[model samples]
Target: MIREGVMNQAQKLLAGLKIPALQAPMFLISGPEMVINACKSGIVGSFPTPNARTPEILDQWMAEITEQLSSAQNPAPWAVNLIVHPSYPRLEADLQVILKYKPPIVITALGSPKNVVEAIHSYGGVVLADVVNTTYAKKAASAGVDGLVLISAGAGGHTGYLSPFVFVNEVRQWWDGAIVLGGGISTGKNVFAARAMGADAAYLGTRFIPTKEALCVDEYKQMIVEASSDDIVTSDAITGVKANWLRQSLLNAGLDPDNMTAKGKIDFASNGADNKRWKDIWAAGQGVSASESVSDVSSIVNLLAREYVSAASELTQTLKPGNRE
Candidate 1:
């Protein structure tokens, strides 16, 4: 039997899915199409608030998505991502829009605020906060976040340096609300590994860049398809934030991956003040090496489910007969 705490959280999140996997809300890549497809597949889907340029547009998108899903009789829960940084001038305005819709889940990144958590809870919505280390996890927990997403090493944009083993182990030692493990998780075996390490689910971003529902450019998708672990580079030069990127993309953009220097400034307003460079920079995690093709979201999820079942069966076989340890 599943642990009562874990089961309750998983049931709340799964929304009838067999596995606990969420398509991490990519900055610009995650859109309504992607979220819709993931939800249709019975997995949690999400998109960032900034994906919409105005509060009016955000409200329209939420209404359309809610209506479309309800009409289809699909019960999978959807989430909205909020950039809790003060730099986002429209944070409060966007929060107001989110309040009107009350998505089943709200994912807060960059910073977690007590009031934000309180607001979501007031509507019976769950709040999941993304944290890079134990320190941030503790801070989010203190803020009353319902779940902690451990963005461990090998993850895509804005990743952490801790191994999932160390990160999850440390967090589980104290906090026990709900935990999701991220970073280099591209396969079913990885999902099993995360659960074994005490995570309630796997958060995936880079693995979905090549999916048909993603809003990435063709060149970007091709790069992910062709690259491997050795082809990725971690640097803070592009966004003034340390993140993993495809090394070939850096070289293609005429930058030396080996000798790149940090500009020591984060210009969220540079590149036409529209976040254009990030579109070309191409963010991916160490697990891109495991991706073999660019397929649709449904196909990718089907493949992952197949592999997960096969892995579970193999584990059962290993423990049966005289093959047990």
Candidate 2:
């Protein structure tokens, strides 16, 4: 996604961030506390609009996020994700809430963001579209979004198939605005690597799922802490969309990971049955192995900041003219 003025808007948005990253929005998992904490911790915090249960709740959540962030010292900006797909019954209603809150950033998923681009831009909001392939990326760029969140291979729920390296390189050829790469990004070194790969930021979701502010139960977080890359299974059987899930979670939900088949459909309705399925069969990315334990958002961010600095320093020394082989 790209636009003339949007490039400036993206710069302003990124300028306030302590790190070049976003706490990728998660359905039913991310909420106000998570968003607030993530922002306060010097990174963009976000959650899907549907997580609020209704448009009114969405309004409340936005208000809460804005109100809390208002007084924080040097807090990073916050974002809200919207399901712009025509089939989503709440698109119009959610847009209304979004317009009122005017979050610094708005992320669109599951459809073209063209419809809401003008509205969001009218309020000086940056619109970033979630795309998994080059086709979607081109379409979103044409639609004039401020940026594109590339959901590459190894992402958790509603995953992408392309490797981050290939996806970022392909998109960078034509779109140089802002590319936030999501998938298998859990550590600070990964964040630095995203920049090295020509991405503006790293989109992290699974790494934060076990954080204290996440809405999931303790058991889900525990499972993430215990799992590894080998324990991740990709299948559309659960949500009718290709997604990564914890192998043990699938078995716990009585579905064999190896033979998993589409059983549920995509539905963003707050009370949709799909919610139950997601709640029961937890989703996580291959990066689960990096999570050592459940921790606070601030602590995790601090750790990432430390690791990012360390990685940058190491790379700098390695690239020195004298050190190079």
Candidate 3:
């Protein structure tokens, strides 16, 4: 049976869905087209506000996604990811737009989202915060966020080093609100594992990076396909935030992954959409090794759905109650 609080935000939000998964709001990569496909395929789609480079463009994206997804057949709820930190100069303005439209879900990153909780709550939107540890998860719970996304090791971009198993268990001890597990989730079996581990759903990023709908360069997508876990390097070098990047991308930037001088600062003002910051320094996860080729969102979701059902059936025989070895 599904847990009690697990159905609070996630269930109401995703009332009727094929798989309980949310395509992570990747910076620059997740745009209108990608978000549209994810929703069209009966999954939550999202994108970061700063990916538009300007608030005006963000407004356009919001309008486009809202119109398209709302009219789509049996569309799933969509979300917007906001960097709720002081460093982002346009946080207030971008948040204004979000509060205006009020997508079903709002995901906050970088810092506490307590300040916006009241406003977001006013519009009946659920706020989900990204947390790496119990500290941030408790902070988000105190802030009245509807859910928490545990970003653990093997996740792409600004990932945590903790194991998802340990972090999820720790968070559950204090809070039982909606929990979304991220990192190392590349397939449907992984999503099932997340739910079994007490998560309401799973959040995936790198798996979507190589998809056809993503707004990424062909080279970056191909690099994700060609690389593996060892090809992923974690360091606070790219954006002054500890994140995973493809080692080959570092080589293309004329830097050695093992030893190099990295001068990373929080430059929220700069645009990395098509420039060296992101274009040359690709952000990926250890799960990139699972990405075999470039495909569409629907195809990937279809494969995940099939895999999830198969895994669930297989677990009935081996992971049943009192069957532990």
Candidate 4:
């Protein structure tokens, strides 16, 4: 049976959405400004704990997010992503900050959520596990998470290999809780398609990387604007896990996209050596083509809302008796 508190918190997170989507927790790209703007624009905003660089900074970020969202008009809920892997040196320190602030939703990645679920649930907060495949999905479900973020193929950063179609359908067979489909989803029509495929919400990361509020540099944003699906190359060289990267950024960093052979070790420590490397080698998914310009979070959301409505209307027409040819 689904835990009542977990289920309720999940529903509460979804209740305020203008669109069934989440501004995915990007590593260095997301911050207080992005989260605040995204919440104000009517979708869940989130950032990884590692983005703060320290627990004190995380405390300040959560405080600012809560203070701002509380004053905003009908702001959607905000989420915090945590690297629950034991090897992450700051996991305990980060979790303490999380407990003190109590973000409405906590997304756990890189490890089991079991270590932090009870503490988060104690404050009526919900936990969503980021799983790349059905095996991880089932394990997370058994760990008592409120939802699963299926990081399928074509996603940015550390991505999954399974197609969303295959992943979502396979997971739905056993789990009835929330399912947030991620991977190459950068448009409202993509969001609508996710819902049509039985996902409760769409998870978007690369789409938001070029926004004004993103912490990334101007050149990074510019690359995302100029990029297409073919520009994204997947390799485990940068982060020791399979993730998509912009081809040009790899070249700029002096690494050949086609010939990268270094399988870097995975380390989530706040002070890890790879931090500087990530800054130079940018990550983006196949959906980078959708970002035609550098815009504000509000404008992006507004455009997405319009596209979502149009897509829904078109679908309605297509399903009408005379139009179904």
The top-ranked prediction according to lDDT is 4
Better of 2 and 3 by lDDT: 2
Give the Å error, residue 184, model 3: 1.3
Model 4 weakest 10-residue run by lDDT: 1-10
How do the predictions measure up, each by TM-score? 0.93, 0.95, 0.94, 0.96
Per-residue lDDT, model 3, residue 102, is 82
In model 1, the clashing pairs are none
The 10-residue segment of model 2 with minimum total lDDT is 1-10
Model 1 misplacement above 4 A:
1-11, 267-274, 320-325
lDDT by residue (tens digit), candidate 2, 1-325: 4444545577568755787889999987999999999999999999998788889988889988889999988889899999887668889999999999899899999989999999999999999999999999999989989889999999989999999999999998888688899999999999999989988899999999998899999999999999999999999888778999999989998888999765667665545676788889898998998999999888999999999999999998879697676
Model 3 lDDT tens row, 1-325: 2355445764467546779899999986999998889989888999998888788999998999989987889898889999987777888999999987789899999999999989998988999999888888888889999889999999998898899999998887877678889998999999999989988889999999988888888999999999989999998877888889999999999889997457578666555533458767889988997789999898999998999999999988787577766
Q: What are the RMSD figures for all models against the true structure?
A: 2.6, 2.3, 2.6, 2.5
Q: Give every collision pair in model 2.
A: 237-261, 237-262
lDDT for 127 (candidate 2): 94
lDDT of 4 by residue, 1-325 (tens): 4343344458557745999999999988999999999999999999999889888988999999999999999998899999988778988899899899889899999989998999999998999999999889999999999999999999999999998999998987878788899999999999999989988899999999888899989999999999999999999988889999999999998888999898988876645576787898999998999999999999999988999999999988879697666
Scored by lDDT, model 2 comes in at 0.90
Model 2 lDDT, residue 297, Cα: 88
Give the candidate order by descending TM-score. 4, 2, 3, 1
